[model samples]
Target: MTDLPVRIRPEIAALPPYRQGKQAGDEAFKLSSNENPFDPLPGVLAAVQAAGSFNRYPDASAARLRDRLAERHGVSPDGVHVAAGSVSILYQLTQAAAGPGDEVVFAWRSFEAYPGLAVVAGATAVPVPLTADGRHDLVAMADAVTDRTRVVIVCTPNNPTGPTVTQAEFDAFVAAVPGDVLIVLDEAYAEFVTDPDAVRGDAVRAAGHDNVVILRTFSKAYGLAGLRVGYAIGHPSILDAARTTGIPLSVIAAAEAAALASLDAEDALRERIDAIVERRDRLAAGLRAAGWDVPDAQGNFVWLSTGAETLDVAAAFAEAGLIVRPFAGDGVRISVGEEESVDRVIAIAASVVESLPQTHAGRR
Candidate 1:
């Protein structure tokens, strides 16, 4: 091996950086990233404009946002730790809880950010494979735990796959795991879930599990992806440690303001969310009706398990101006995007599904 720069950690040197979703052209709808389709609510936009006091640093502690969240979740202000994004909080929590020789467990093919976070934390990632139906294999995940295991992250409506862990399943998993192991429920897409059986982080944390932390973001449901504000609800001590590992003052004033404004405009936003949810359902149904064995899509997206056809399937989507996130050798995740984009995606997907040979993996 060649001599590396300033003795960078060999593993860090080998690790790949996070790859963002491909950007769409002006004529194409970008559904690669699981982002909200609606523009920021008018109120949120107003808040951002009013927060244009760029001359001063933001409140580093983010007390107002923290307190607001604390009240909503019925936790103390210190229990809420805000960051640039929920992914950032995930990284911070990883850093705070684990280091070299430690292991972090999560579902395979989950949020693409999971293994990357563990790598940066100098921890080993033990990714349990998802069930064939695209749900977390909770029993297998629990079995993967060893003494070196320090943290477990559960993402639901598991990204790229769209199946959510049920509250009962989550409870059973929690009961099965060791008490000392920290579990972070990544709920970035929680608001998009309509299933009554879905596991909700806030409810789990409220049940007095000191080892559990619930993560959420304003990026998805709140339509603040560009602004990057997210938070965690957990035991104060755990959150305090995560906060310390985070970049100080990283959550900007505009983001804080927009988050606050989002809360104030929750009713309006809920209506918008409702529309998206309806659209997501319609799209999922359309795909299934097209003979694609789509999974239970509880989020604002659907998972097309094309297996070996993943790349070819994605190319077909791109050819039709539907840019999707394709996990080669695995599947394609098509985010439920703009209303117009919905018809475009489903139409292209239907053609792709129909054109597939009878022997294709997803064919009934």
Candidate 2:
């Protein structure tokens, strides 16, 4: 397509383009991206305003933020690695651990970014399908690993479809994999998980796993998505390898300041998170009562198995002034948005579910 003679990797060219969640107009409830509906905590806003040194570059290592995260996770500062976002760290870890002739294992219909990241790193993507209720088939994922498998990623409170792996499930899966294969537990929605049995990464790391990396973010519960500050906790040697792949000076001062401030205002932040969790549970309950096969939603969103009518159901929500993320034929993902949007979402969902045949996949 270009006049200039340039060589491009065919695999890269074949990868699907990344699409962001649809933006909403002023009158619409933008629930497509699972963003925290709450505005930044007042203390965090103050910190961002106080960081006025735009003329200077940020600390490349992000030592302050790293230390803060280490303290929270009860790890040494050297074990913590900071990056712009956890997704950015995923790409780095994939690049660091895998290459041509190697493979990366994760669940299908999980994070939309996983396949592309593996492709870019020149590793083959081996996606195990999710179970009917949308939870990962961890046994299948563990079985997929071969001698050539370089990395295994487990996403808890899985994105798009919201079901988390239990601690027992995670332990069995980990035991099945070879110790040489690096395991990355992506817990971006950890703060929102209300499930008593869900696997928490910090607990796993505390048990002395040398090859596991726990990835987390300030983007969700802490309301710092715009600033893009995420951190990883693992063995320092593994983190040192990942650090080599990151872009220089990417985690800026504003993000670090906002994260630190959010940590300081933990009680207020937890209150807001409590509100979101309550609303999320209510929304999922309402959807299921209305005859939809709503999955276990431990995150701040619910998954509707809309199946073949995914796009149509998504359009109906948009028409009713509620934006949702749809994965074409698979299903639609609706975030637990503002309190005002809840009734509208439930109303539209009920109407849509009634139209489907009782035997349809989305129906209960």
Candidate 3:
């Protein structure tokens, strides 16, 4: 690493940039990103074409899309805030809520971006470890809060690990947190969730907790990952603070158009989501049957608690033409990809689990 002549903030200098999942060659199934396998809706491209004004800047507020989302979520348009992606909104919320000497609390081994976001905001990152089953231990998280704590992020259908914070669990957790702390419910994979017990962000918004903000993205279930459009729903005042910290005009016209089109084609989108949910359930079940201690996967991916064998198992999957997200010694997260990939994952997983030592954590 080269040092610049200019002085850099030590925390900023120390922070590693966010890493995207590896891209696969044409032959391999790219399941590392937990991406939606389906293509964009039929109306999506046409909408992008309709909004083809390359010379013009996008509406900074993204009014139409905000209005549509507000209608869908039953919130006022001012309650909605759009950005480049939900992760971008997370950054904005972090900057808006926390700063030097403040603490940002979230589950460890969750989103790879959480810690970096806090650091970028000049805040201390308080990472509470997840439960053995790969679920957020909200009780422990609440216990981590202190006077310096400013923001708390709860990723439902938690990324990488694939377990959701149940509705009751979320309710209790919210009650435990102080009113001054902002609770950002990150539901990037909310559309893929089928569990009746899972927390619903929209319901939370309707209940009107001023400190809570719900984040959703067009990237996942809507299959608009390339466009990079996502929005937040919460109290207008809270959103105003986030807007103060956001990069202007980051949400472009094409992304906004595509999101609006996706909303119009909800029926078609629902079918794709339902398919992904079904695939995810089957994948989780197959891995478990293969003697892996798979977690409750409510999202569009499954977690393999590969423990000490993490990298080796991930490498084996890669050799078998499956690219999965590996968290070093923790586990491997395999997204529910093409229908054909499911059986391949199961076969490779069965062999890998058998190869592990008898006391390996991944073994059932």
TM-score of each: 0.97, 0.98, 0.98
- The RMSD (Cα, Å) of candidate 3 is 1.0
| Model 3 Cα lDDT, one tens digit per residue, 37-139 | 8888979999999997789999999999999988988989999999999999999999999999999999989999999988999999999999988999999
Per-residue alpha-carbon lDDT of model 2 for 144-258, expressed as tens digits?
9999999999999999899999999998888899989999999999999989999989888987878899999998888898999998999998999999998989999989999
- Give the higher-TM-score candidate: 1 or 2: 2
lDDT of 1 by residue, 203-283 (tens): 898788889999999998889999999999999899889988999999999999999999998788899889999999999
RMSD of 2: 1.1
Candidate 3 off by > 4 Å: none
